[model samples]
Target: MRVMGIDPGTVVVGYGVIDSDAGRETMIAYGVLTASVKEKPAQRLSILYKSLEKIVLKFKPDAVAVETPFVSQNVSSALAIGRAQAVALLAATNRGIPTFEYSPAQVKQRVASYGASSKEQIQQMVKMQLGLSEIPKPSDAADALAVALCHLSEVHVSGLLGEQTPKRKRRSV
Candidate 1:
């Protein structure tokens, strides 16, 4: 399966692509799409949407996974992140690709075996899992990769469960 992961932000949106088959995985691409803070809010969103559209077209991933924004006391920041995440969803949905959402904690847990894993831990785990020589740059890209890995792990577990035979339920007297 080919998966594209997105970490949405108004100023810098991160993206990562990977292909998984059987048990092996390969990193296809990972990077960030930036928009100037000086631009108007609409323009910034436009920039992100268009850039993500181009990426979706180029890589043509089978599934798109996005990291949900971490809710915080900053209301405006949270709203902006939500808008950026919508852009990512549109980029995939417009192309008829399946999209999944994963919370930051879930991504961290799947990648690092702990829901509260630190950024450095996530970066290290992502690097080691992908067999990269060093941690992915700019942090955001590493985060995006973690999102993708989380989706991959979820799908793998689901598939394994699907393969198992179900036991019949018994009614109590």
Candidate 2:
């Protein structure tokens, strides 16, 4: 199964695709989509949608794993990121893909064996997990891959689209 991971932001959206089978995951594609600060909020979201749409069309992932917006001291920044997060979800849902949202801490714990793992630790762990020679760059791409890997570790593709959804929602963990 292929999972598309997303790290959403107004200025930059990171995406990573990974294929998992028999408990092994291989990296398929990873990159960042950038939006200029000069663009308005709506324009940025539009760019994000179009960019993510193209990715979904190209990769044809079985599911999407999105990083939930992290809390920020700045309300405006947080809200902007929340909107971008919604766009990421929409990008997958529009294509009839099931999207799972995970927090940064969740990704870190699943990928690096710690909830407070550093960014460098995450990059290294992701690289090692996928057997990549070098760490994924731009930070965001690695983060996205981490998100994807987390979902793969926690849930299977069948669970993503089946009756497991309600059980997943009700789980305390």
For candidate 1, write residues 85-128 as lDDT tens digits. Answer: 98899989888887888889989889999999999999999999
Candidate 2 regions exceeding 4 Å error are 156-173
Residue-level lDDT tens digits of model 2 in 1-173: 89999999999999999999888889999999999999998998999899999999999998888888878688888788989989988888888888888888988988998999999999999999999999998889989999999888777543666645423522121
Q: What's the lDDT of the predicted structure labeled candidate 1? A: 0.88
Instruction: Output the worst ten-in-a-row residue range by lDDT, candidate 1.
Output: 164-173
- Candidate 2 has an lDDT of 0.87
Clashes of 1: 0
The number of the candidate with the highest lDDT is: 1
* Best candidate (score: TM-score): 1
Which residues of candidate 1, in runs, are more than 4 Å off? 163-173
